[model samples]
Target: MPIVNFAVAVEKGKAHLDAGRPDLAAFLFGQVLEAHPTHPDAVNGMVSVLMQMGRADEAMALLRRGLEANPNHPDMRVNRGALYLMTNDYESAIRTYEGLLAEEPDDPVQLVNLGGAYMGIGRIEDALDCFRRATEVAPDYGGGHLNLGMLRMVLDTEGSAAAAEADFRRALDCDPNLHGAWLNICTLRRRAGDPEGARDAAEMALILAPHLLDYHQNFAECLLALGRRGDARKVLESLLQVNASFLPAELALAQIAVDEDRPAAAIAHLHRGTELRPQDPLIWANLAALLHRQGRIEQADTALDRALTLDPGNAAARMHKGRIQLAGGRLADGLANLAAMYDLPEVAAQSPFGRLEGAEPAWDGGPLAADLPQGGHLVLAPEPDESLTFLMFRFVAAAREKVARITFLDFRGLGPLAGQVPGIDAVAAVGDGADIPCDAIQRLGALPGLLPGALADPGATVPYLTPPPAAAKAWKDRLSALAGIANLPTIGLLWCPEGRRDPGDERALPLQQAERLLQVPNVRFVSLQFGPAQNELDELAQGGLVTRLGQHVDSPSALAGALAAVDLVIAVDGPAADLAGAMGLRAWVLLPHMPEWRWAQKDGAPIWYPTVTAFRQARAGDWESAVAAAARSLERMLGD
Candidate 1:
């Protein structure tokens, strides 16, 4: 080819490269290089094409040749440094950029590139310095400000969020189209608890780069943080439409499905995610969690096994496996898994038992009877859950006969409730400055484990709690007045389970199911159900099946009085049932198939509450059987 043809071919190659057609550009550049071997444009074009094609070695060789021909070519050196950075050769990229900085110390672009290389190599302090210097040298440069802001966020020290936010704002002011700066700002704002600001920034990022999946994800996360779950769901679903195999979007959608009680949809989304990223332990672990929630124990175990196989040190998977084992009644295996979790640093950090961190010798359940103080024992109450509190009352009652003095520490200010128990020397709120003298302290929940055979004795069957006399009298008088008009058996009905943490646990029977009890001849039903279920009470009243006493039954003392006034208490597994059982009332406690471990029955009744009859659901999530059985029992009690 003639020199003129070579020049034309080189120009065409450059045009094709600029137009994003690296393949055709490379061929044209190759033709030029064959005739004029040292042409700068042709050499640079070939190197760019090779780099775009991911042929790092060929690109580097071509760049070296170009530098050899013109040893002081600044563009060639810059290109070589960029190639090193692209290939993740951080040391080489750092060396090249540092060399350039030595010649042009104030060049913001070179400083930013060097900072990125330092960041790649985990020299975070050095990277920060480089970014700081770049921003200082060119205060108006939006890219430099952006890099400085991003590095500040990565540091994430006490006041770094404020600094990062300022820099990001500055960058956006300089270049309004800087989507990355907006994203970082959004994240920082979200972390700082400014969800509205985060949403605004995320929206700006999406407007700037609508096609970027990460921008959409950030927007969705911001929406979720702002509690706009519906909007977030739409955005996530739209993102899945754009890229179905996007693992993050799929995982988010699965979480949304789980929150919405759509377990099948959650499982389907997770299954698709696992197909897309089969090796990701988190995806498999999440799948296992959903399965565990559905009580698919064996399938959950299989999924967890796969997750642990992929990543042996997966803490979430290990914790989940332990919970599954416990739920499946494999106590030994479950405890072993939990012990493994206790050994894990991350797990230990999040555990409630983390406060037990020390080098003190751990206690196994050995003979510690001699360690019990003979004089005064201070019992620290567990969390204010009714079942736990009632259990504490039993332990206190049993220990009362043994210890000289027993002081109850009611953490949740249940003084009125605790006041009704007979044997306590005093009942004090935990933080109320009641200086009780005691020789020993014990957590209420730890009593059963501490004294293994003590609770199993049948002698512990007596009712330990009593209702306040005046309140009980008031309730009895009110009931007497109602009975004179009705001439029927007064039954306290608690059809709904209270304080449910998981929506999937259908322990609460539908009011329609309790219509069986209402249909029983000569029975007056009083509502013991509480907490925002007035609509349910109204529906029952409209049907003339039950009457509401929820307004009068407010305090724990009042609840106890109400329980004492009724002939029988038919309740789901909740505080109402526990209260009735504690008051020695005849409670037919309707239980789910998986009622809490404490409610485990030995002789058709809970061992903890001898007066309470256990009507347990035979199948998981099926309340009808338990409700029907309770109704039949009520019919027999009424002699109808």
Candidate 2:
């Protein structure tokens, strides 16, 4: 053989492989291998070139011939094992690695490859043991520590992150420029609710390995957690340009759109994500939820079915499916779907209520105290949203008969309205409720499912909640104070009155958009819209357009009285709708093209509210149609 520059040839071949020119890499490797067929490095170089070119069968053939000629060739055996793994022949791959480990038991490279083989077959414990042994054999090897750390995360599914963090730290100690370790640390910190730490780690990972798409995705999530939506959006948009079909980048963009109050944009992003990764169940589930919100019930159901078909165990898919079924009146199926969400580890960890002085039995809407010698004291879990708390008050009245006493947990400002609800006992502020000696607790959302036909009582849907006399007097006096307030029929408006509007608030009907309704003759439009949105009211009030009415009412009962003072309430879907429906106040509820599960599949026929009428949008984000319909409804009402 002419003295060949084999080192130069192999180096040049590797450079070609790195440049993604596998054809050129194969030509150079072949030239060297022809002269020295049995040379271990030459054969390995040719095999790598063949594998890179996606000719795995040719690579395996070369490995087989080399191993046959040199039965004790370690390099050929490792190459054969890698080929088996590439072909997804798990049994062959595992046997090959095991045979290699038998010869070189302390080789961290062989040990880690075996661990990966075990992982392919779902033997996670075996994989974890292999990774642990690899680290034990080579304490100073960064690759071993990195593999150990990553494997520990999978093994310790519910354990503390200390072990993984420690291993990752050791990996970094072995090599400070290990981008993989930094990426894992970012993910670990984000999961632990340390967004600040996650962001710092993510920035380092991105700086170290800007080529990796996951670093960008992780960075965006960290930014989102820190309420940096604009920054997150910019990062994700740029990431998409690098790889348009990047699934995680698309999902993160969809979430950013939702945060910015742009549901239409959110839905568009989610739809594109579904197209990019059709088999991804969560994307389909999210799309279903957004569709269900827009009143596209049939389409939402179709998307949900596809999601469930792909992944029956997907928690979000199940929850949204349940909500859709319940909205469609399929109570049993909906409840079954909800069971997973309610049983999630996070939800299960919450101690909703404390043990009362006496025996506290869980009230499942069943007749309590029938068997227990000690009577049942039912303590209902507080609603996170004040509207839900009030909505539950009416139905909870029926539960009073099942238990000796019923105590409503007042967490979200429901303390004031407790007196108005016809129930047995006091309104215990959340913490105090646990000490009241109650035997059992129940989630207010579960009452309908627990007691079949229990909510069918006509009286429950009627005007069950009453405004306090004092609250009603305050609202009436405030209305009387306005000049000519009593002259024309009053219509309460709950649209968002913000100067800089949020596009994501689907229920937000901008005050300016109500110009047509304002044109309705012989009607006094009072501002029932509240919160930061009042700034818009102040701007219009300066020129004698619309005065803020919410500034006058502070409590839920007071808001209820304010609603009662109006002849007809025209508002978007929100707390006002919940109160209006509960009070049986005649109101026109402007609905988004896709409303929430609370309103059910149809707009006009809300089961909980008999007097309220729904004005649904014909297209997504088109409040004009719903508002126009409301204006027409007003014209008709005035004519009547």
Candidate 3:
């Protein structure tokens, strides 16, 4: 009777160990062994606890003795197989499980466990077969169905959405409460473009286990894919409420906040997340990215360093650190870092020669003025940024002073009134100047309009060769005027850098804000906006606050004429501002919180453009203040 009581006590101890109460189970098993030193049940229970606690050597020692006493125990064989699996001795585990299976042909649990061991050894086909056999042995085993479905998902083609859906459906049929099956089904529906179906599957999973974090995360992903970002946020927020320390939900929230242009909120959540999971490499990398965008370059660098220290093979951390160095003006260090990590696309993009819009790299100081000596040959190269344009403009003006008497043909092509002034000696519109050297040819070019971290071939050139003077000027003038006056003191607003997918570009002012210039007494605001936002300018002009001037001009001369006529130009960090500086026009340039490579950090006047005044955004997403400051500067200029 006392031996039976000892067995009951051992059973309770094993149950505690199964439920993750190892400390309590060890204490209970100790009490049982102290009272009954020779009890087989007590010895077995203590061995199970040791195995669960990962003390494999201790567990094996006791199990060896127990198995010597009872050589035919199926449970002992199964336990030993599990221990082998834990140690990644897949061959041994497989042998043990197969022997047990031979003795008991219809053991569903062992079949599934054997499949897991096969998977560990990269024998995916064998694992799939084992799971399939498991289902054959136990047709109603939900876990086996789910395992088979997951394996099929990997083995299937990218277009096998239908097959994936079927497998997930069968898994659910086997066990209605299989949350993983529901999650996979929802993902399949999403890939198939059936949002409602995805939502239905997600809801079914949530209904079964509302507290399951993975189920909630899957539902949130479905909501995001369905264009219900707000709903997605709510689901993630609920998960956070349930478990504040949940890293997955916190990271998801941070990403959503960034997409919605709430970088501050993203930073806040990520800060807490990194603090909670200080050792998680991913958390540190994510935090670094958010910090970098928010203008916290130093903090971002520190975070990236921490991530690299924690995980030396973290490519993202290495890439981000290189970018931060580049942004911080550590050019050589950045370049070296970038070169080291160029295998990463992001690092490759940090190169100055990255893909640029309409990019044309100047010859490497080879054959200076080879194409220039031809009289009436107009080299129409629009400036890329205000700094470069300003320097080039001054250099050209100085070069003209130094090399007097050479027939240097000048053409104005970007910004307000660029072509109207007409002070250059031999300048003429294309096809209009007949007196010029017939042997002379024109070389017209456009700005590259590149952004930070974009990469291109060393000698990439623009698609369209620079047009003849009149034609190039016409297009440049028209585009510039359209950008500046598209709404009125033609504020040539450019809210983003070319080639950037970062959040700083997307949350810019709507074109309607350009119309706000009409509110200023006797002032006209113009649209200098470019890139994707240009598509909306025509619609914005219907309000009559701004006029679209870029419609007819494809040549630079067209834009030059428009640039020559505007009163004052205001712009964000873009090529248009550079065009204005090259034309020697007064402009107010709105800079990002941290200026780009050309702008530099000294805080005084920019060296390239003397007529340009730079205004930096005080904080991230504070474009409103930047705009307001521009309005005030305009008021003073117009004597308002």
Candidate 4:
């Protein structure tokens, strides 16, 4: 065998691979290996290039030949183990790594690979232990800390954020050029509601790895979170320049266009994505949604057909199809699809009891026995959001004629008020499922599909969740004392809702826009807001323009009572809006331009809530028109 400079040849091979010409890299590596058959660098480089080119069998043959020549070769051994991991042969990967560890103990890279194989097999505890050991043996190895940080987040997403972030930062401290550690820190910063910090970390990642598509995407996400739409778009566009077929960058750009209220631009991006990957169902599904929203029914239908054909279980496509059917008066079909939309992994993760996991089979709004051993018991599981749960109560109220007895397996902090709802016969906490009487169980979200006819019957569903009479009286008395003028029409109002809200959260309206409604004549406004939003009413309260229902606003029951006491409830789309709608109260539900499909209008009202009229922002972030319309409605309804 000829003696060649293996060092220079390996460097050239790597350079070729980095230049995106794996074939050239493979040829160079092949030349080096032919001259020096047992050279580990040549074997490893050639193997990597072959794998990149999807020539795994050829790569394996070359690896075996090299290993036979130099049986104890470290790089070749590690490459073989990594190939096993990549091929989903977790057991083989673990064995290979363990065998290697016997020869070279406490090797951080081998330990990290072993941890990955353990993770592939879902042995989370083992994976954690391996990752910890890798860091322990090689504290300066950034990869070990990076792996540990990622695993911690997966272990308990919200709970482990701080610790995971610390690990990521530690990794960056050990190796300043570790782009992956910086990327993880960016994710953690975003989760901690520090998008500025996230953006900074994302910038570090992008600077380190300008060629990495994932880092660019993360940087764009950080920008989006910070409400820098133009900057995010620039990042995503540049990513497309790097890799024209990058689906994630295309999706991100489309979402940014949606945020900017540029439906045409969003559609154009989705169309570009389709051209790049015609078989990708996600792009097709998204295209369908925008087309449907714009009333391009035929185009949307075509998109939906293409999406569903590509992936029959595509939830977004199915949900949009249902929306189209509902809009077209295909009631049952639409309801079923809407039902499917709720049955998503994200929704289930939001609530432990989002769906019934009872021993009894799920009831599909079927006729119940007049006398089950326990009197026709049926457990109603909850939806992810409180607003959705409130809507579920409407469905329960409508279906009261079918089931003899009801037990709501309430989650989502709605437990405090579940028993107070009109049709609920009993209420139980989520974990007390065993104690709850249930002959059969059903998900609250499933009600739409099960009882579409009943839900559609306004008479049956209306006023299904009335605020407690005594609670209402208490709120009314407080308002009467506070207002000084007993006969003035009282209005319950909300701008920002409780929980996570940002500038990009369209469901929340700016308080300044709502201040105009507070100045209406003849009507006294009651503040149905909590936390910092209540502070916005200080000036109005001082001027006697509004009455802040301070303590009552914090309690769910008291909030409902406030709604009952008011002559009208005008609010943004959230729990308050859903509560008013569920109670069949006269209310105005203000909507963003791209509201969820359930808020779609029918005869000037939300389709799900016949009594709640909607005032929609014609474009994103343009709530002024909607606010003005609500003010006029307020004047007509209660103003002098």
Candidate 5:
């Protein structure tokens, strides 16, 4: 071939590079460089192709040869610096860029590259200065503004969020097609509680770069936040079809399945994810969580062990292991694992309550060195679950006897019910933020650990809560109207299987299984189930098994009255059972083979609820046996 054909080869290489065929580009450039060793275009083109192929060492050698041939070639020098940055040789990259800047002091591209090198080496302040200078030198440079905004986001201070938003907007103004800038704006808006704005920004990004996976993922997340879960699921499913090995898409599908109460589907998705990425501890941990929710304790433990083996310091895996052990009646082992979470730096950093800061050491269940201040101690309710509320009531009643001033901070608008508990000096809503001037604050769930022997021997049970007289009378009159139809015993039937998210929990007796209880000769069944389970009630009514009463039983006070009015309450282990125990009402709680820790395995009755009888399933997911035993018990109660 003619030596003049070297320029033709170089031209062909440039065409391949533009067509996104880096391998072909590299081959053509190699031919050109073989003929003309000092050809600048061919050398730079080969280096770019090598870098694209992740052959950084090869790219560096070629760049060195190119710079040796032409000592003043700026493009080859810049490529060399970029190769250093790619290889994570931040110091070398910084020195190279600094040398380039010395020659061309006001080069915006060099400044931006320098900023990236500084960021790679943790010199955040220096990186910010470089980005600022780059933006100032070229006011229309969108990349400079984008990098500046990203750094501000990482800083994450009080006013940094707003500043980041401004920089991102400026980047978009400079270049409307900047997809990265649009994605950042989407995230910032979502974090600021503007889901609609987030959706708009995400849509713009998707339009600009439809093939980008992150844009699709973030758009789906925005849809989820806006309560468009169906839409989110469709988007995620489409993403999975495009790339089945995409871990994020798999995890998102699992989350949607969990939310929709399809544990089987969630498990399937996680199983596929684990198969694809067997070493990912987070995927194994998520699988364990779903198994635990389904009451598969042994399987859940096995999954957690795999996670812990892969990542021993995983706080989420450790926490889950502790809960599983606790559910299996290993209290000491469980508490030890749970307490270790507080000591883990990763866990402490993630806690929304903030790290255990200040001069005062964290109260680790040790005896108080001295009495609390005159203002006494404040007890904050962790959540609004009925069981949690009742447990808090027990702690408050016990603490009031010793502490002079005990204040209860109720966050769930449970002040009305908490006010009913005697010895509470002040029952205030959390939003009130009334300064109680307490010496120390204790989370209500933490009280059990602080009180020695509290779990070992749960002391005498008492009626801690009662329905208001008016509410009780209203329910009584409501039930009296039904008395004329059936003079038999009135039993409140609660057949809710699981919480909203956990649709098919093993602890819940299926309505079909529960219908066997209604077969008992003379008993009136009233539905105590809540939420959007009217369809379930209508099915039971069609089968002549139960009557709906959920409409009248809305508030907690009303629920208490309904429980009080009934002759007996039959329910699974849920809020209804917790309420019955709190009110000291007669109840028969059906338990799964591996019940919650609160329902410790026993023979006759639970110590916590003297009037409640717990019937356990012989095997896991054997609600039929539990239902049969409950049926016999109900029949015997009617005979009595």
Candidate 6:
């Protein structure tokens, strides 16, 4: 009667397991094993549950015990074989599956299971053979088709999209409720850029099982591709409602928040996601990137450290951490980290994104131009305020001795500032004299000079130089004050840069909002901008809420000098913020929802600029919220 009771318990456990309640099934199976010490069914059920929970060692122990008691039990043997696969003990799994295959050669399920073990060990060809054979044995087996399709997806070429698509579709046809097949189909559709098709497939899968988190994430991606961002966000939110622990859903939510220019929300979502999935290297890497953008360098370091702990060999994490260290002026530490990465086999072969080849030094001064001479004298154009170049200079100063071997050449317009600054040899305009080969030329905005038809001839040997602190500071104070107005809160406004075409640039406010800022009591708004929008601002500022400074400031350093006298600087996506950062000036930066990589993924006050604060758009293409935040900060500042 006791043995019969064990049998009944095992039957109930099997039913629960089939229904996907592995925890409940495991509990019941444990009771059966307690009633009958050698109950094969209970032992198998527990092993399966433990394996699903990633407790591979415990599952293996149970399998061994089952084998000791009933060595020839086919189901126990199969379960033990499966447990080996979970532990990545592929050799053992294969041996066990092979032995069982001898006893039940026609068992299609065992064949499919063996295929999975083969795939886990990277034996793609063998796995394909097993799946194909399993399919042949049971023509209607949807799992066999799904497994075969997945293997093909990895090993096949991009050109084989049609084949992969057909296989996935066939699997779905064989078992209409097959979730894996549906997901794969959506993935294939996405790869082909058929966003609508992808969304439809994902929706179909979700209809069958609303609890599939992966389906929700995939559907969100599809919706984003289809330009249905609102719909995608709703789907992600619904997923979080169903399963708060869903890591992928959180990542999707963060992406949506960033899309809407809600960097604060994005940061919060990412933090929760990382906590739930601490072992996920991608999440950690992303969190570090976000923290760094917000200028929280120390926190970024800690996040990266955690990521490396989760995956010691994650090359992306190492590269980013190295860059962050370099940006933070930890020259030796950053360089050492970057150099150490070269020892990693994967990074040594190629960076996670690409080969880590050192950038080639540009040859700006040219004998090729023939009119150029080596070591030609030149003037330097003062570095732009708050530019990437300024950021690089801070790194150089902290690490100067280390980079002493590198040469420094100033551009012609910038020669005066170069003379006034600490380290420099000579300066020349791109067209000042005969083209010359120099060790370096500084400033990225000067990239036009190196273009094909620019003044500097091709093949000239010239290295580009980054900004020094004094040069960066001089530029912001000089240019920002050019608007020629007096008083506290001497606001510097830069709505856009000259020449346009910058994807990151945006119209900071509508004419109505610009008027509102001007109307704000006691705030002196000055236009230090250099763009065609002067006419529009003049029309908008006719009553005296704004002052245009472009005429007074001659160069970036002059602007920097002028900016130093101002109480506040407000800008968006230009060298001005970088200049303000270098000068340690109190500045507010208006960033689009999807900020550049340098700004990181989340919105926060950056660690790179102690005096700078960020205001992000609340949604894509919406500047209303950002302007309001600026207004609030200004009001608070005035009140204080």
Off by over 4 Å in 6: 1-8, 104-106, 210-212, 220-242, 261-271, 274-386, 390-494, 497-573, 576-640
TM values, all candidates: 0.69, 0.70, 0.67, 0.69, 0.66, 0.60
Q: Indicate the residue-level lDDT of 63 in model 1.
A: 85
Model 1 C-alpha lDDT versus the unseen true structure: 0.75
Ranked by lDDT, the better of candidates 2 and 6 is: 2
- Give the C-alpha miss distance for residue 350 in model 3, angstroms: 11
lDDT of 6 by residue, 1-640 (tens): 2435777788888887766678789888877777776678789888888876789888888878888999888888988888777778889989988888898887788888888888888888899899899889987888888888888888777656787777778888888888878888888887888888888888887777665567778778888888888988888888888778988878888878877767678888999987897778888888887776565768888999999898887777887777876555454455445545545675444321122112223334332221334333221223323354454443322222222222333433444433333333444444322234433333332333333332122112111222445645765555455554444467877766442335434534444455545666877777776655544665674446776665555566655655665678887756677667666678888777645433432135564565678887876566777877887888888999
- Lowest-lDDT window of 10 residues in candidate 6? 455-464
lDDT of 3 by residue, 309-331 (tens): 99977877776776677555564
User: Across residues 1-640, which tens digit of lDDT does each residue of candidate 1 receive?
Assistant: 5445877887888888765577789888888888777677778778888988789998998888888897777777878888999999999999999999999999999999999999998999899899889889888889889999898888888898899889998998888988889999888888878999989999999998786788899899888887888899999999988878788998888888887778889999999998999999999999997787666778889999999999988877886776676545454455345445555676445433343323122223232243455343543444336665675566555555555565666655467778767657777665523344455555454454444455545226457777889779988887787634367778887766662333465667777767766787777887766666635756663356676776777677877888998888888887778777777788888777656544655565665677889888877667778878877887787784
Q: How many residue pairs clash per model?
A: 0, 15, 58, 0, 0, 66
Taken over the whole model, the C-alpha lDDT of each candidate is: 0.75, 0.76, 0.61, 0.79, 0.77, 0.65
> RMSD, each candidate, Å?
6.7, 7.2, 9.7, 6.8, 7.1, 10.8
Worst 10 residues of 2 by lDDT: 350-359
Q: Candidate 1: how large is its RMSD?
A: 6.7
Residue pairs clashing, model 5? none
Ranking by lDDT: 4, 5, 2, 1, 6, 3
Candidate 4: stretches off by over 4 Å: 1-50, 57-239, 248-270, 283-305, 315-329, 350-356, 364-367, 395-398, 409-424, 427-434, 459-461, 482-484, 497-503, 539-543, 636-640
- Indicate which candidate wins on lDDT: 4
Residue-level lDDT tens digits of model 4 in 1-640 = 5437778878999998876577788878888878887688888888888887677788889889888987888888888987887678899999999998887789999999999999999999999999999999999998999999999988875668888988998898889988888888887888788889989999998898776678888888888888888988998898889788888898889988887779999999999989988998988998998887676788998999999999988887887888787666566777677666765677556754543475677887876776777678778877767777877776776566788888887554566577777668887765534556567888776776777565455434567776667778888788778735587777777877563345667788877677677677777777777767677766453335766665466666777888888888888888888888888899888888756655766666777787888888876667988998888887786533
lDDT of 2 by residue, 23-101 (tens): 7888777878777786666687788778765789989888877777788878778888888888888789899999998
